[model samples]
Target: MSRVPRIRFKGFEEDWEQRKLGELADIIGGGTPSTLNLEYWDGNIDWYSPAEIIDQIYVDRSQRKITELGFENSSAKMLPEGTVLFTSRAGIGKTAILAKKGCTNQGFQSIVPYSNKLDSYFIFSRTEELKKYGELVGAGSTFAEVSGRQMGNMQLMIPKTIGEQHIIGVLFSTFDRLITLHQRKLEKLKTIKKSMLENFFPQNGEKTPKIRFSGFIEDWEQRKLGEIVKEVNRVDENSNAPVMMITANDGFIEQSERYSTDNAGKSLKKYILLKRWELAYNHGASKIRPFGSCFALTRAANIRIPFVYHCFLALEDNPEFLEHTLNGKNVENQLRKIVSSGARMDGLLNISFQEYTSIFIRCPIRKEQDKIAILIKSLDHLITLHQSKLEKLQKIKKSMLESMFV
Candidate 1:
């Protein structure tokens, strides 16, 4: 009996054919040239390693180049532009369609698909299945590696018609382009925000910022954190609000999302209540925010934040403005001085609320504060919108991968 995909494009109706990996394509391996030979090191040839084959759908260049003499001496062989470059050693099944002719190191056991039977993009899009198959059959004492023979022995379901394969390949190619576009936009927006944060505020004890709105010529006033914000210790003992924690990138997210299941039981009532636009300091250290992170509850509803977080309310300042300002390098420097070395064992910073509130902050007048807060808040909203679009696009591709493949 033959098998068919759950979903199909218009004007196509046929069960997918079963084929061994070798029948559909030739599986090949690569090797490195002698490192001591200077002749092999740098040349016009595009030479790739397993590490270079990540996230990208098509690869046209390599970090390091090799000469024709290098290729002749090594086990490495040229893979055509349309070949699917698969990493079969160290990290098996990472794949990319070669944008141009290239050769890789020993870490790859790439596939040269037959033009009449298989599509490169279609095969690359279904790397999850290949990864699973590699995991089952691969064996090595040091690190798992799939030989050419083992990879060729693997089986797959391929559409009988080359037309169907082309359609599927084109579909995935479009998806990849869209995902890459959104990702670049997201990164660009974040870069802009970083620059704005640096330039919009005073730096190095300077009274004036490098960039400012027109008609605001007065030097900024220096005020203690105690004067600009006050700690909020309000706990709702009987509250049914959702438990939350601060994430460096996403701000406040559900505690359940972090731990997967309701990890907060009897400790729920002890959680501090954070109202709209109120801030909380998460002292847990992560590479993204090494000195801890401050986040605000931008959502309209109030939620219960972990008691471990130092909660704060904006006093004589715009809430969003204060929230953005608290994450600056200046604040991180202050945090570094106060964080005890012993706290490193627990992945948490040790700094008292009194000491945190005593740090000095320079600020403009009320009108400028409101303007800065509104501008920053708008950027956050725009970022959230783009983020949502990117997530939805990814979800669509994931769903398509499941239903469109057998």
Candidate 2:
């Protein structure tokens, strides 16, 4: 790729100059206010630690607060607005610029740029670029850490004029805004789905939900899950079907798609074929209730009729209702009860098909189930789209960071 000439202001050569961070800026470390002294802790000042740097945006507020006494007691000092706060340990290398005056804990090293020599925004971006270098230097250690002195000692190339620095900062800031917008949309979509689930599903024995499809008056029936879906646990060794792996997130997916294998072996048992709209669940994975983990099949797969996948969804009288309920806190509590063991590290939990089938649920009519599923699925699709856009924006920023600086 052809390299663009270093940017510059009028009458300047535009050639980049190399300087140690210490020469261009003052690097300071943050201290923690005493937690024991209530007066020294929750005051007006925003207190930051490495934990607050995950989003990579300029931080206007912190997750914590400290008082003047707390600030004075610790090794940390207050950094002025526009100082760059970089994580030194625990999620090492993430960096953000402070949008308001605040103090941080020992896990961060704040950079304050010298007057007129470099724009704070430009230094923020450059510090981000330097973070990759810090990681390389800090490699082979269990906890990646770089002191304020180390950050100051690192050498960097920069345009001599502040005007050019501000321009580059503005270009990247636009991309950051686009990314943050998509992230907010994704959060909204999830909230909508949660609210709809609570509204549509019958709560604690009210004959009908206050919110339901218009004109549907038939009372939902309470039925055992086993009565609705068959449970197929037969594993035939001779079957040529694809091997499946189940995870908490995606539910069931082809094992081959998730892993690279030089050795492929055929399973002896054939799985019952599954069709679209069928529900599946895993007995092993439970977020709310240990009864089963469930999902509606979006694709056809040759599997069992009582596939753990569908059976997982078959709870809650309606599969759609069950899907949303599974993610709720109540369901999680029930799941904990159904599972035989609390040892997650063992990767084993006992939930019998018989017990699962007998679980009571308030079932809506099939038509209502279809409607609820469609609405929730549509929201899920929107969430997925926004998440994909966010990922793309992040990737674009990553590429630019790699190419724009030396």
Candidate 3:
């Protein structure tokens, strides 16, 4: 029996032919122009690097463009519109088809089909599977790199007819488009929500916000955060709460979803019982997010947070409004004022609990706060919906690619 893909399109019975990539197409290597040469700097020519291939299957433009002189002076070659660009070193498995004529840096082992016989889309799909072999044969003293020769020698199970290859390529391409569309929508929704937050809340030293609901003309009252909320450090050893992690982006998430929860012989009494609607702030600092972060538990499940997190209860207040404000820049600067004047080796900020609670915050009455929070929360729901659709489409495409190829 001839070796074949697990799945096949209708009216296709011929087995795929096995051919080495070098025998089927000419593999072209790329290079960068000298940075010292000012004459070869920025121009109209599209110059591609591995970094530009992120979350995209087809590339019509490059993040950095080069001059014609740059392209000529370097080892870069002007590939045709259908050429397949595959990164060989950093971001090893990133692949994209050229939507227009372009030249790539030395990071890629691009393929120029000898004739129209090889479908660029099909080859792009196969590039994901070739990553394993590339890693196996790659060699370098400092970092692993796959050479053009190795890529050329890689074997591919090519379909007997171009018609069959087109069918499979089109199917995967459609799914990729849908995923990309949803991803763009999710980003746009988040951006809009951020704009709304900035306008709905008062800025530093400003008594009134730029935008507000009807009939509320009273200036927001300024008071110590401790006046409205009190610190809570309740610990329960026998509590059946789900162990959770307070993240910068996702707020409170189950510990098992992101990491292993193997606290061997550790006392559960040390873990704080985090009730729903309570606020938790991580004092740890990192390069990405300085001054730490805070979030209110919006999840339905009552979870147990680590003792390191500062937990507090909001009394006679809108929890969602507080959470939304904490996520904004207005509260970030207020929180920074109370942080101790020192940075830990691991980037943790030294924040005294007493000073943190004493920080002042300005807020409107309960009715206005509730209105703003409800509006922002609705946008969050829409973003989440789009994100779920994007993930589902990506998974479907991945499964199809696996079964459609050898």
Candidate 4:
């Protein structure tokens, strides 16, 4: 195996030492207190489970608390502040160093390093490395578990001086903080978009929303969908036009490498040659509410309307209104009724051209439709920008973990 080189700084040699975990620390596993005994729980003592520790960066708080009675009755041990906690099963291998005194369930093994030799932060980081090693050893097993004995026997390269360990720990902690800040920003942007979608659209019994396009005072007209537009399905095997996919969140895309291209052996010839502004629905998959299952396709075919895709996607008419309403509850219920069980496996909620066209829609003028589309599109762009930044930060963290550790 390759080894890290020793370096000298300020008249001191920083040599890395290879030693078993048991030689440097006391390995302690935990147990769950009986939930039936209410007297054991609901007190001031901090108690942690695997679920609570899985995603924690620092363990300052816990999901549950225990009393003196509970602590005495159970196998749980009160670990002091700065002890390293490592998960053992199920989600397996997550590690966190406690910031305060705490107790843990059987799912974790806490390591209390020998006084002044190893820092808690350095041990926590080493446990993370061991987790990856354990995954490789346990691959193909039905249930992978890392026993306390196995953990104690595992070997790691450690620096003799505590000062060097502290410096390495501080560097990684700074990266973790930056990643967390970007995550919070992404969450805030999502909340804003959700609120705007609800407020800008019509609500129950209010024909016209309080908000309107500038210089437009007309109330929207309620008309049957068939009167204004025609629904056509052209499912041709020979046509090589790109297979478009729809998603609930992203609307439509021309290419989808993530999904299979088979189309489930169903005939696409019956699918309409979608034009600009023409609306389409994925009636078959809408029942289960899968991601990218239902959305308006944006790319235009041979059609005349300017910004046809935006018109269908815009929050203007009752179709737009109906899209939101159907997405919530109505479509799922309606799909359940239409599903047919048979040998052909033709169990899908298909909206017929006649049935879909006959549905009534409340529509604003074309000019107002254009305006609403522009405003919502701007918000969508901002949401996408933040999402990209979050993804990039996550990638950087992953790369650092691979490079920084020996």
Candidate 5:
């Protein structure tokens, strides 16, 4: 009996036949040219590594190129365009079709599809299934690895007609293109925000910013952080507030969202309670926010965070402006300068509330601050919207991949 996919395109109602991968494509092993040979380096051939196979549907070029001598001298064979480059070791099962002719390092067990039977992208779209299979069957004490023989021997259900394979491949290719487009837009927005953060505020010696709101001619006033904000010393003895945590992305999120349940057990009463529009600084450094991050409670009711976080309320300064400003590079620079590398308290910063309050910051008048805050907030909202859409599209693509292929 033949197997049929759970979901099918219009006018495609044929049962798919089970076939070994070798029947559809020739599985080929790859090799790397020695780095010591100067003559073998930097020629016309594109040489790829397992690391290069990330998230790309098709690879046209490589970071490293090799000479024809390198290809001939090493076990690496010149693969034709439209071959599916599949990594088989260290990080096995990453797949990308060759948009141009290429050869990979020893880590790859690439596939050269037989034009009469297989489509390069048709195999590429089955990446998740292939990865799962590789993981299940791979063997090694050091790192799980699947050999070319194992890859070729693996069985798959494929459309009997080559036209059906092309349609499925095209559908996924379109989805990937859309995802890439949205991802680029998102990155562009982030870059714009970074530029704004860099130029919108005054530098160390400068009194005014490089960029400013129209009609704001006055120099931004310099003030100590203590003058604009005060630490929230109130504790949630009643524990009525929802426990929250400051995240690098997504700002303030409830405790349940971070950990399936409210992991704040016995120390619930010690949690800090923060009202809406108030700010909290988590002095825990991460790669995303190296000097830690501060966020204003723009949404949600009064919430409790761990006592380790420094919670504060903005005085004359707008909470929105202060949130972005403190999280900006200017404040982060001051933070980096002050952080004592030798002293650390449980992987969190050992700096005190008093020290944080003493940090100096330059700010424009309240009106200008409000305007800049509005723009940044708008950008953040747009970013969030696009991110949500991208995530939804990815989920849809994942669902389709599972349903449309074996």
Candidate 6:
């Protein structure tokens, strides 16, 4: 079917044209200088490898530079500022527009657009789909790759007028910037939370935190974890219960996707039911966290977690405080102290309920603990809000890509 975009900018009434990429642009290939030659290694020109082309939308700088002598000796050619750099081998499908002149290894097949008929950003926006096509026609024994001849013959559907292409490119670029902004904000918030967690809690030998909130001047009390909470060992075959798994970094998340159906058969009885205000800990050792991770459930009463996780409820201490305290660096250090030398093949800690309860942890009074948890939780909420916005923008961009191009 011959068609145009579902959505178009005002005054763009003409239908888009379908043309082979080779007819619309000049295709260029790249190569590397001899590694054995020390003189050919480093100089003033930007040199990129397939590994260096990652999630970046545009690339201006490279990790390594090549000398003019090296460039003359190698098969690599200098691509212009607006050239679209696409990896055709090894790490296939990765693409970026050059913000400045650069050269890449033989792994890339770049495109230099004919500006009179094509817009660079417009070509850049289509690189993702082009990557899909490249993958389809690609062939290899060691790794899949699209040849330069294959890439040139690939077809592209684009607006007939350069003005329309420019408009569409700008619109998608704006959305990309918004997503990048939100992602940066989310990362900043997480870094702040990590910093605060370290500083808000006292060190191993200290009686008080380095930074304290106003009106909380007294030193924190040293309390055995056993003195604060008792392990809850309860389970039932309530098939209606929501199934969840405790992740080392992401906390509790639904594991329903792992199951074939909602009716999990006899396996449902093996699951542990957790009530509201309870704590769940992944007692398994992981590469990221040797002692595992723990978090308290703030959701309503019907959540069911796997039996692999150790469940506990606060009896004397504040539940919210215990959750954050255990996740903090000071308490994590305490956990590291008590872990048994022998870990199970499945990675579960050999430390039993008795050993976990006997571990000592430092804590502030209930009033101060509550205040700190509230402050940190508020920051978490803000981070979540921005993350959601970023996800939404990315989804919109995906939809636009589907409808705006043939």
The lDDT for every candidate, in the order shown, is 0.86, 0.69, 0.81, 0.63, 0.86, 0.83
Ten contiguous residues with the weakest lDDT in model 2: 261-270
Once model 4 is optimally superposed onto the true structure by TM-score, how far is the C-alpha of residue 57 displaced, in angstroms?
A: 1.5
Cα-based RMSD of the predictions, in order? 2.0, 4.8, 3.1, 5.8, 2.5, 2.8
lDDT of 5 by residue, 1-406 (tens): 4388888888888789999998998888888888999999999899999987898778898999999888899999889999988888878888888888888888988889999899888888888778888877786446788888889998999999999999999998899999999999999999999899878888776999899988999988889998889889688587677777888877888788769444667777788888898998888888888888899998877888888888899988899999888987778889988877723757688678888778888888899999999999899988988899899999999999878875
TM-score list, all predictions? 0.94, 0.78, 0.87, 0.73, 0.91, 0.89
Show model 3 residue runs off by greater than 4 Å. Answer: 31-51, 62-76, 89-93, 105-107, 114-116, 141-144, 259-264, 286-288, 341-348
Model 5 clash pairs are none
Q: What digit string (tens of lDDT, one per residue) describes model 6 on residues 127-177?
A: 778888888888544578888888899988888899998989899889878
| Residue-level lDDT for 15 in candidate 5 | 85
What's the TM for model 3? 0.87
Candidate 1 per-residue lDDT, tens place, 253-324, comes to 887887953576777778998898788988888778887888877775789987888889887787777777
Off by over 4 Å in 1: 259-262, 342-347
Task: List, residue by residue over 1-406, the lDDT tens digit for candidate 3.
Answer: 3467888888988888988988877788788999999888789899998888876787898988889898889999989988888888856767888899999899988888765567777777776677777777775536878888999999888887888888887887787778878888988998998789888888877898999999999999887788999897989889888888777777788888887666613845688888888888787775545767778888755788778788898997788898776666766787777676767774567776677777777889999988988998899899889988888888888888878887
Model 3, 103: alpha-carbon shift in Å?
A: 3.1
| Cα shift from native, residue 371, model 5 (Å) | 1.3
The order of the candidates by TM-score, greatest first, is 1, 5, 6, 3, 2, 4
Clashes in predicted model 4:
9
Instruction: Please tell me which model should have the higher TM-score, number 2 or number 4.
Output: 2
The parts of candidate 6 lying over 4 Å away from their true place are: 36-41, 141-143, 235-243, 257-263, 267-271, 285-287, 329-351
Question: Candidate 1's C-alpha lDDT?
Answer: 0.86
lDDT of 4 by residue, 1-406 (tens): 5344333234435457788888888878887779998998899889988887765678888889999999899999999888888777767778888899998988876788887777776677565687876565545468876777877887887777777667666766776777777778777877875666555554553556567767977777666655765444434556566666554555556434445556423544443355554465554443246211334444555222111112233333433344443343333444445444311244333444455445444556777665665666677777788788878877876676565444
- TM-score, candidate 1, is 0.94
Q: Comparing 1 and 2 by lDDT, which wins?
A: 1
What residue pairs are clashing in model 6?
none
